[model samples]
Target chain A: MIHVVRKLFWDFEKEEQWLNEMSAKGMALTHYSWCKYVFTETPKNEYTYRIELLDNVPTHPESIAYIRFLEENGVECVSSYVRWIFLRKKSSEGAFDIYTDLESKIKHFKRINTLWNSVMWLEFIVGLANILIGVTNYFNSSSSISLVNVILGGLLILLGLVFLRAGAPIRKKIRKLQQENLIRE
Target chain B: MPESSERGALTEAVFYILLSLYTAMHGYAIMQNVKDLSHGRVDLGAGTLYGAINTLLEKNWIRAVEGEEGSRRKEYEITELGKTVIQGELIRLGELIANGKRIAGGESK
Candidate 1:
């Protein structure tokens, strides 16, 4: 079964939960395209999944090397898209989770926060630009279709606001990790 | 002096990594060494090991060596600087153990 989810800035926890839910339903993710995840039927909860943000997957030599290493260590490489790799290993009592210690967990959260922040920055700038351009055209146009510009401007501004609002929760999680880590050190 | 100051304290991962890489060892080998040395108490996940390797490389505490291409067989060895850092870590650890022992039992005269 293939499910399409359009989440522009999907944070780590949400993505992990969705994947785990799908896995629990006996659908193993075999591939991903943009926002679509393609799954194949398997035994319910056959494997536990992990999603990692790494650059240059299935193409770059280093990424290939890393994947090969994991496969050798009993992890299966199910799919990859953009900077994300979806991995799963047979469900067991042994550690299937990628992060085992506090330091690594902290680093993983920091990486996730950095990636999302960069994407949100780009989205905000584009949204602002679209609204400005649309509003300018709306006021300057003498044509009957000038109302179209107003609608488009409003939509762009709303979309930008949505993105900005979505980013706050993830940033709060990252900040909490940062502060907690400092206290531990 | 600057390297020592910049490196600060070694995390267990970094400490065990340097210890394991006395000979050129790949990722799995290093993980195995750490787990074995710590009597199976310390285990390094693939992700954790990968992140630690990158950090060590960036700081020049470790350097990649020749390995068969396309294998997790990407081997690394500790640099001279890495050895010095390990030595410093051992001294610090010794001091810590000594202080703890004094509290646990009686102080050595």
Candidate 2:
């Protein structure tokens, strides 16, 4: 049986956990695109899922090499969205963790932190530009278009603030990992 | 100065990886070799191994072997410079062991 689920997640870790939960319920994720997921029915606990953000787009040579390496190691690449890849291995494979050391874990979180930081800045710049244009339009001639632009600009800024807030936990994770790295590896 | 800077201690993963690549092995073979060499102490995850391999390649510590055309599995081997670095590390480890044994006063176990 095939099942399709429509959902969105900004937190990769949470998404991984949710996918594992779905697998536990006998739904093995077969594909993913943006906010959509497709699954095939399978025996419960047949697979373990992991989500990783590649350092480059999936088609990039480096990314392809990395994926091929994972495949050689028994991890299957199920799907990709932008730079993020969904991976899985048989549940009986004995703890399929992609990062086994403190340094690697720290590096992974730092990558995620950099991503969120870029997103927040991009939203802020675009939002500020829209607000500036809307204000100029309003002053030049009063119109509903100006009001609509102002409203949309305000919403974008608000979304930017949300992204900024979302990045806090990732930053906190990086800090914690760095502290641990200092004491250990 | 760059050579001196590179003399700093290597991470456990890098050390094992370089050691494993001395014989020109592919990725999965390298992982297994590391695990066996460490007596199951140091296991390299695929992602971590990929990152370390890239760094080593950039540093010219390891080079890809020219395999038969169209071969999907690529092999890597340690460079001469990499051998020098690992040898330096061995001497450093030996000194540390000798110092600890002299001060701690324990039989070599």
Candidate 3:
């Protein structure tokens, strides 16, 4: 049976609402003391498996908690796609199945990166426009444009550049996640 | 209870999934709806779409309607809560458009 856990990055209240709703719909859920949602598909033999779904990137504490949990339990935790799963010593077939799932996750992350790149292009254009607005206002002899506007525009340009810069890190994280799956295989 | 503006912070992927399910629709159908709505500008990858759908279901903004049991192509509908959220978004967008129109008019003759 499949298991699901969630480490939310977005609004905690919204996340709680989501967990409650999902639980109401017959999902087996165990709300941990921290912001971890542990769910299992069906009770099997001594061997059990679990998965986690997180909307936003988890905090360092949450990450450490998750890793530590797996390490202490001796369960092999693999993160692929957006969900990370814990696997126990099961049949060879189960191992093969897990690998397939990880591979599929890698494919999904690639698609996610592609979409992010598109957003980055849009941010870059918006940033460039802001910079131009600032530069044009500064160069203009007319005093219609306030110094504050120029400064705001410059800040906006900076923000856009930061977002544009953020795309690479996002890409790197996805690649790193994918690599984790590969290293296991 | 009245929804909070903070609650409107659904992820882009999740919001798109909810938007797609404004009508009773299945996974593939909702995916197609998003593609069409975005004029193909937004393509919801299967994994992303599935993940969003699962979260949406968990949020109660979207609920599953009757469909083939054990089938992945389960149909879903926007709840009253979901509709309220959508209305709020529409109003917000309307305000933005009106402001833009006023600004553009002021800039012109």
Individual DockQ of the candidates? 0.54, 0.71, 0.01
Model 2: DockQ vs. true structure: 0.71
lDDT of each: 0.77, 0.88, 0.54
Off by over 4 Å in 1: A1-9, A56-62, A101-104, B1-7, B58-60, B65-72, B103-109
Q: Pick the candidate with the highest lDDT.
A: 2
Model 3 residue A80 CA deviation in Å:
9.6
By the DockQ metric, which is better: model 1 or model 3?
A: 1
Q: Which 10 successive residues of model 2 chain A have the least lDDT summed?
A: A142-151
Per-residue lDDT tens digits for candidate 2, residues A4-31, read: 9999887888999999999999999999
| Winning candidate number (TM-score) | 2
Task: Compute the lDDT of residue B44 as modeled in candidate 2.
Answer: 84
Tell me model 2's lDDT, rounded to 2 decimals. 0.88
Local distance difference test, candidate 1:
0.77
Look at candidate 3 and tell me the lDDT of residue A69.
Answer: 37
Q: Write the per-residue lDDT of candidate 1 for residues B1-109, one digit (tens) a residue.
A: 2566653567777788899999898887888899999998888888888878888999888999988777636789999888888998889899888889979757556
The digit string of per-residue lDDT tens for model 2 on B33-93 reads 9989999888788898988998899888899997557877888999988988899999988
- Backbone clash total, candidate 1: 0
Clashing pairs in 2: none
Q: DockQ: which is higher, 2 or 3?
A: 2
As a TM-score, model 3 comes out at 0.37
